[model samples]
Target chain A: MDIKDIMKPENMVYSKTPVLTSTTMHYCPGCSHGTVHKLIAEVIEEMGIQEKTIGISPVGCAVFAYNYVDIDWQQAAHGRAPALATATKRLHPEKYVFTYQGDGDLASIGTAEIMHACNRGENIVVIFINNGIYGMTGGQMAPTTLIGMKTATSPYGRDPKLHGMPLKITNLIAQLDGTCYVTRQAVHNAAAARKTKRAIRKAFENSALGKGTSFVEVVSTCNSGWKLSPVAANEWMVENMFPEYPMGDLKDR
Target chain B: MAEKILMKGNEAIAHAAIRCGCDGYFGYPITPQSEIMETLMEEQPWETTGMVVLQAESETSSINMLYGGASCGKKVMTSSSSPGLSLMCEGLSYLAGAELPCLVVNVVRGGPGLGTIQPGQGDYFQACKGGGHGDYRMIVLAPASAQEMYDFVDLSFELAFKYRNPAMILSDGVIGQMMEKVELRPMKPRWTNEEIIKSMPWATTGKTPDRKQNVITSLALDAAVHERLNHTLIAKYKQMEDEEVRFESVQCEDAEHVIVAYGCMARICESTIEMARKEGIKLGLLRPITLFPFPKKEINRLVPHLKSMMSVELSTGQMLEDVQLAVNGRIPVNFFGRLGGIVPSPEEVLEAFKNSINK
Candidate 1:
């Protein structure tokens, strides 16, 4: 085929969104961040608010998310992204603001900031990525880690008395008065990817309408952190992760 | 017309913030400084100046709000007392590391840990040194009067943006609570989005097709990169020390004795000079306005012209060490201060000065 033919609009399928840059992402293979980042980029591109979207990227494997998203970003310290989002959304109500946080960041260290931000009814979106382990810190047990999960910090498996139960943060947030929409999802396959994209789009749309806090929690898999093959990780996530964190809309308003 | 208001120092801070075109003010109520936010709540600047004022759940949330606003290239600030300021240290460190411009007013109270609600300059070491972790310095402004509190709000923001760094107004309980006449400046319109793009080109206002997306971050994983950032911060501090030293030298010319003080203590020492001079002691007062730049050079210049120096403070001689460093052993720098919220009178300061001179 000629070069011109390859560039033809009619031949195009699954081209990358302009909202994401050509820069290579730092996320590991089979890490959920890449899928989540793509969904956000596609949603922003689709909404035509690429110029008005501000992202607060938190500390974790996805801390360098700004490099790939190509949107204005404020890199927040560990769990402080929600606090940053609250201010950004309030100060510029005309703009769309969101925070991309990990399980360790959101459910653990930054619990207070996230809880208060959601409770304040700040018009913003929160995209929480949850795996069972802290990926950046070498597979440590996260607050969302499964009760019997074995990991670096929980060598003998998580004890209910010592580590506490895995936090159902989305359910917790759904109970708050300020959150307009809250849902749990995953991106294990092309079908799931499309569903997650729709969910993220809904979140962005809600923020644009000043609909308080809209959250889309992605129960993602970390193949490296979980010490499993990418295929096995997906299978394990379906069999094991789904029962604990079932993929469905928990709340919507 | 810009009307002069008889307002408390904290209230003047609120008035001046509204007039200074602050885009947002996030704070939590603390003793001696709750009036700062309370006044903003009463005035409701949203109706007039379009300023966003929020009473945060805690100082932690307030400082992070400041971080968010600062990242967006907006003028934002927060006010708190010593204990509250302690709670904000982590956020302050993050703000400094990111090189974000914002204002933090510390209406200092006595504290080892919530020691008293009354005024104290005990946080001098915390303010002058890096209050947070890492190698960084905030431009610490010591406002001794209600007028200074009013004036320094604009000045702190100016310095904050000029250097792309945090600036602080380190006032004490006396300065925060005292009522006095203040000349409120004319209102400045908040920066337009286009103006912000022009001024803070690196701020994360929004991403445009023509420009690379702005990322306001302080993280650097590489050792070399982190070291270079530290060097840049050190250079900025050096520049600040050179250009931003502010102090009031009262009667230092040919005086035999000098009294070094700042904030409310400086105001008290102003009267102490008069009392000391009457007793045939040629005493002068060196009041440091910008405590971080520290007026070191100016104080050094007066060393040869002074016989002895006495440092007066509300805390147990917290600022005396800086005075000694400025003197650099050229003269005897005696320390005299009241601990745990004791406000010293001019006579007490004079007595301390006389005792030092006699010794």
Candidate 2:
């Protein structure tokens, strides 16, 4: 077969989702953000909800998530995305409203908003990206940072008595009666990406069904902030992060 | 005509919000303004008018909720007291920076820091000046009566959407707690989604193929772009100052001394003017209805006809500074106030006025 014929539409096995803007992503090479962004865009496109989805971007690294996602977006102040989503979903019950938040934004600065919003059962999806460190502000220790993990602020490793334990906010959210679907997934590999995409689609469906808040926590990687090669960061996340976070559905009611 | 009903100022706010076709009311409970949310919850507008009334966990959450609704081109509002309003400053700055239209009612109490629940105009500077960070101005309306409280909700929403800027009703504890006969406006219908999408092209009603995706944000990474945003906001504020200045002048046409006040203080100044008239002292009162657009031109107009100007407030010379700025040393500007939640009596104001004239 000719190369041109091989590159034709019928022969194509995969294509980029049109739900994403043509603008280049700012995520570093091997960063899980790009993969997660791709999954969200793909799911929105696949479901034909590109015109019905409103995204709330957080104040952390994914603050520019609005720039990459070709949807109507509202950039909230720090951890206030859930609060913003709550009102957006309440005011526009017919629309699909979701928030994309980083660990520092969701677990640290915005803990109150996240907890109350979940408790209220706002009927919105919360896409929590947990990378175990603050990626945007030069890898500072995050709420999800392991007890012995080292970062810019925790140079001597995180101590329980000093810095406290890693916050498993996803598990806490799963315990909330208001959350109808709560799952923790990853997008480090092709299989994992497929699994995460399925989880995202289910969460979006749950929102439309008016089941309540659907939380999908993506255990991601921050290669640049982790100060490791992209491949090494994935390895580190799999070996270190997966053990603590663990994959699979915590709650699916 | 809608019949008059005796209502508390805070309750009037709730009734007016529903009647004005507000799409949502997100607020936290606070003194002098708790009646707003309580009344909302009791009325259950969600069943009738479909107005979403939610009591948020905090003032921070409620203000951000308003930001959410307003971004979708909804007529949303929130009410709080001095301390609660203080907590909302960050959200207010974000709303202004994003240039989203919404209404905020602050039934102000005394405060430098959790001061008192009594009436005080100490927040005059905070409201008329920037309450939060950045160079931004909100359309501020001061309501002296329960009627004005009911009336300003619609007016505030109108100006808010007109300018795509935040509008505030800067009421105090006195007006909020006081009961007066208020003539309610007929109920207005809430807009449909299609109406919003058509009227507000910049709203985040999700992406459509025909138009560009709307992004509601206050973040500007580029320094030059941020500066341009700032310039745009300043120009909008300049336009508001030119076209939105609102005030009421009483007896200033033939007077030697003019008293300048706003909100509840203006009501008390009416009595002061009456007392001065009996004593053969021609005292006039210039009440500023819009605190931000600030009747500066009116104050300037009174400058030539007065021997001296007295700024009466519930704070220590906050609005007095603006009056002085308007006068610009053309005549003497005097200040009289009772601090820490004291609403000075008319006799007290009369003595202060007499002292100012004697000085």
Q: DockQ, in order, for the candidates?
A: 0.85, 0.93
lDDT of 2 by residue, B8-70 (tens): 999999999999999999999988789999999999999999999999999999999999999
Q: Give the clash count for model 1.
A: 0
The residue pairs found clashing in candidate 1 are none
TM of each candidate vs. truth: 0.98, 0.99
Clash count, predicted structure 2: 0
lDDT of 1 by residue, B65-124 (tens): 999999999999999999999989989999999999999999999988978999999988
Write model 2 residue lDDT over A1-253, tens digit each, in one string.
Answer: 7888779888789889889888998888988998999899999999999999999999988999988989999999989999999999999999999999999999999999999999999899999999999999899999999888889999998899999989999999999999999999998899999999999999999999999999999999998988899899999999999999999999998
* DockQ of prediction 2: 0.93
C-alpha root-mean-square deviation, each candidate: 1.4, 1.1
Model 1 segments more than 4 A misplaced: A1-7
DockQ of 1: 0.85
Most lDDT-accurate candidate:
2
Best by TM-score: 2
